[model samples]
Target: MHSLPPLAALKAFFVACHAGSYTAAARELYITHGAVSRHIQVVEKWFGVNLFIKQGQRRVPTPYALTLARELGGAFDTLSDIALRYGNGGRNNVFNVSVPTTLSLKWLLPRLDDFYARFPDANLQISTANTEQLHIIGHYDLLIRRETSGTEYSAIPFLQDHHCLMASPALLKRHAIERPIDIFSCPRIETLTRPGQWNLWLKAAGLDKSAGNGIRRYDHFHVSLHAMLEGIGVGLGPINTLSQEISRGNLQPLFAKITVAPNQYYALTPVGVQKTLLHRAFEDWLVSQGQRDIKLADLPL
Candidate 1:
């Protein structure tokens, strides 16, 4: 017989580590914070090590806890895939995808008609979730995400995530922002989730951190982009996400010569499953369409 911690304890530990708090885990698991705490304690006692430490009113996962959580997450993902594929007798020709909302709005939705035209028989169902939780790999057949280093799944690079400063034409003219440094005089729109984006882009452009002043923060990139479009301030815009806006003249690029090293958009599939015909067809179609979009966006007026 195999010995292991109780399944409930393992699940609580996984959710707590991922959610970053017992309360959040409790909400997600439909349990109380006290129950979440007790389950974690059970796991910690079974392992004879502390999984989390109290840090200034927050429960932070230890390094060991993070490692264990990642492993457990992967195991759960595999089990989910198996159950979805076999236990329920998987549906035919239906492809489910998880994507970030901003990407869905700015990039994917615009070109979906072409996807359907090419693959009429394929029923594509897309769901959106917070980008941070994407590492969990739920029931979706595929996930489109910003490429991160060292992922366990098979990934196909779809779009280059080149970033640059973007602002409405009205804002630029109003601020007389002729140069990159001039942007500091105007409000700087920021995405709360990617706090370091402005810093990284400014550093790459050879500007000091102080140049990113007059800040307005938004919880999501889409909101920040909307604020920028409303002539609120300049924002760091990734090419894949903002290309259509630039093309439509809703927003214009600033300091075009100064660009950051491109990150990538990836189409991630479960490990060892990329060889399937349906997965390959969709990946190929997606990549080809993305390449076309990038080419058109990169062209000079």
Candidate 2:
């Protein structure tokens, strides 16, 4: 057998390289910064090379270290794939799904019981992360994300998300917002990630896009939606994410007469695994449930 550094040391090295600091690596690995540094030192001693250099309180990987990291990352990915393929016997029934945090909390979690009820025997694991980072589809049986036209995976359109103005009934009553233009008179809740959303909605509504002011920006859509729900202000709500609240009268739609092009929600699965029974069943159920929740004609137009 070839002499190799300890797996922990290798892991620490990889995390350090990826995270760019011992402290960050430690946080990710659930160890102390000192431990991460020692692990890196161990790996460096085994390899007889300086893997990183201090640059303004950050550990920057050397060119050779970067090359090594790339190779090691690929190796780890391959090993993980192999382990996932054969580690669980044919009886393995676990289905792993990754979804965006907002979508998970606002949409999926509410209906997860139905899924569990239908597939009680199937082990289900749901993880939430940024949707943009889900393109890799690693270690997940399925991903729910905004539809991309890429051919990397087989995508099933689940929900057509249209942006609309939404607010609590109390907020509307307080502001006396009888028309779309009246929304600018109240506090406008916006998300940092989608700053242009209000402009898009305004332009679609045939109003001056630059008219709104006093915008309060939050880092996440869920937080912004919560602010609107608590009667803080009006927010640009994606129909798919706020449909249940609107249906329940917690949020009132500002203008249901105008509609804009929609960003679609898609259920993505790796091409090779699409034929699996669990994958197919989950996809079918998700699509069916999504259709039942919002019909095409029901979409604002």
Q: Who wins the lDDT comparison?
A: 1
What TM-score, computed on C-alpha atoms, does each candidate reach? 0.66, 0.72
**Compared with the true structure, what per-residue lDDT tens digits does model 2 show for residues 58-161?**
88889898889988998788677656655758556667788888888888888878877988877777888854665553577788888655776788887777
Query: Candidate 2 — which pairs collide?
Result: none
- Residue-by-residue lDDT tens digits, candidate 1, 42-85: 99999999999999998989999999999998888777656555
Q: Candidate 1: lDDT over CA atoms? A: 0.81
- In the order shown, the candidates' Cα RMSDs to the true structure are 8.8, 6.4
Which 10-residue window of candidate 2 scores lowest in summed lDDT? 292-301
